[model samples]
Target: MLLPRPLLVLDLDETPWHGELGEATQVTFALRPHLGFFLQAVAQAYDLAVWTAAGNDWLQAGLQAIKHETGVDLAAQAVFLWDRGRCTWRRDEAGALHFRKPARKFRARWLRARYPRERILAVDDLAANYACGYGHLVRVTPWTGAPDDTERLDLARYLLQIAPVPDLRALEKRGWRARL
Candidate 1:
């Protein structure tokens, strides 16, 4: 059989979980109701993983809770966990740990080399991620209102529709037309 679809290195920020600010809203904290179906639907074709600023425990519990709520076995297929790993935290010429890009370009580069997949993808909110030029990168707009987040989840589901993606560029291309 064909090699299993390449793993999806999903960023957990605004793409799946609420960003740092929405920590207070328990209802939305778990990406369960939002993207659980997307994950389950795609699991049939591709492996899943979480790479986010959220700590492992939170991400782990959230995954468990998602399966509890939606009855999907995501934990069984997790391929990696880059969340809370060493980030771009270093002093500059001035010796200040400031301006750390949310993601470690260096780390992404390493993963790209290590994972055997000819195709890889990342989903995040910030524009900086696109700078790395990974094959597949998806960004979620700031979730300011109820409809805003709901809409993001809807778009996320769409990506799962055509996974095992032959063309990484296709992920970005498919969602735009639906939004128009």
Candidate 2:
């Protein structure tokens, strides 16, 4: 019997798209270059999910924009679309407020049944977001409307290359771009 595909948990804001909060609560979204192609390529190797520190409204609006613009219905395809409610509130030594996506949550019975810790990976622009689960992180440079950015394209190649690894979390993902 074939084993289950690994889980690829993705971050939303500043990772896949950049959102500008316009007047009257409108949000203008700029998608990363080659986002659609990246998603299509990665989906072949893993089950996708969205985990964002943004609130529900922002998440929904961004998803709508992503669907309308890129023709990729990310929400529909994602196993789960998690928002700020799922994040842990944190304060740094400077007392600055932050929201962290605690990796320990993966130990929950429901999630572990489908994806063991070693079979899971998370892509995020902020390394701090995965402080509790550093082993699972595949850090990407933060995106903010760089028209020439090829991060996602290169990232797709990297992810595809690593998909067959038995324990994704055990792999050293730093300098992954250089590897590709």
Candidate 3:
């Protein structure tokens, strides 16, 4: 069976931007410079989305600048945007609710209701709390604007390797039928 286009939801803080959540005042370099190239590559196959805790204005402004500065058109593939929710801090440590992490579940409910066949792959640095029940879920290490392609490529390749594939053979066998 064929699979629906996968959703690649990325975090803006340390994953894409350099650090500090892409503030308007700070416009230096990105945490992952190769993010531009990686996003472009994935754009060919996946639907992109921005899921961060940042407000809309800040999110749009920073993303706009990134595209203008890098000429990567990072927002082109973005199909949706979701800023994480605030949780109650009354509970204890773990239970205190770090709902700030952008999760697939935030959009998963509607996604399922609308398009159940499609899946969401969450790309984040901080630990995530959302589970959208998409094809898969991914997590990248949180960075502080280091600007490296090696790590970015590794992560991107990992995403491609795991996402949009069917059955264990598509993963473990790593050959033959995958090309079909």
Clashes of each: 0, 0, 3
**TM-score order of candidates, top first:** 2, 3, 1
Per-model TM values vs. the true structure: 0.63, 0.96, 0.69
What digit string (tens of lDDT, one per residue) describes model 1 on residues 1-180?
454365666665555555333556444454523566667666666667766656676677666766777776656767766555533445669885532234334246556564443455665566554554534556556543344356545655655665655665444553442654
Q: Which candidate is the best by TM-score?
A: 2
Q: Write the per-residue lDDT of candidate 3 for residues 1-180, one digit (tens) a residue.
A: 667666677777777776353465764544466766787777776778777776666677768767876676656656776564422113456675444442335445667553343355666665543333222335566777554445566666666765666332123322322342
Ten contiguous residues with the weakest lDDT in model 1: 98-107
Kindly indicate the candidate among 2 and 3 with the higher TM-score: 2
Steric clash pairs (candidate 1): none
Segments of candidate 3 deviating more than 4 angstroms: 20-31, 85-97, 101-110, 113-118, 131-136, 167-180
**lDDT of candidate 1?**
0.56
What lDDT is reached at residue 149 by model 3? 44
The Cα local distance difference test for each model comes to: 0.56, 0.91, 0.58
Ranking by lDDT: 2, 3, 1
